[model samples]
Target: MVFWLVAVGCLFVGEASSSDNKITAKSIRVVMDNNYPPYAFLDAKGNLQGILIDQWRLWEQKTGIKAAISGIDWGEA
Candidate 1:
């Protein structure tokens, strides 16, 4: 999934952003489950953690673009 996101960013960076009828920015917005451990979870320090965060680091390294993540309830997903 991380690879796919990076790929999509690389392949169609401007095209999709331009077509979307929403706010536009150079960064990408991503939402994740707040309590899923080893994937994405809130830490004791109230920071994002787990394997997905590591993956996101790699994604940012490869894509050279920024990603903003939000943790929210699955129902809100």
Candidate 2:
């Protein structure tokens, strides 16, 4: 899937560019549109939610990397 591809690509790029070919960063930043609904959005409680949010959480657990996921207005994005 596209998500997996992008995640892997990021890892690859990180490794490829590092002096020791390793992922040196402890975290990654991800931004998404807050109004996209099911894919990504702010819930009634004003928290990030939806499929992308879930996937990113899982990715964080699996990769052991903190993902600072945030959302902004689509137009601003």
Best by lDDT: 2
Model 2 stretches astray by more than 4 angstroms: 1-20
Candidate 2, residues 1-77, lDDT tens digits: the string is 99999999999899877756568789999999988889998878999999999999999999999999989998887
Tens-digit lDDT track for model 1 on 1-77? 99999988877978877787764456898898888888998899999898998898788788777888888877886
All models: lDDT?
0.84, 0.91
Backbone clash tally (model 2): 0
Q: Kindly report which residue stretches of model 1 are placed more than 4 angstroms away from their true locations once superposed.
A: 1-25
Query: TM-scores for all candidates?
Result: 0.63, 0.72
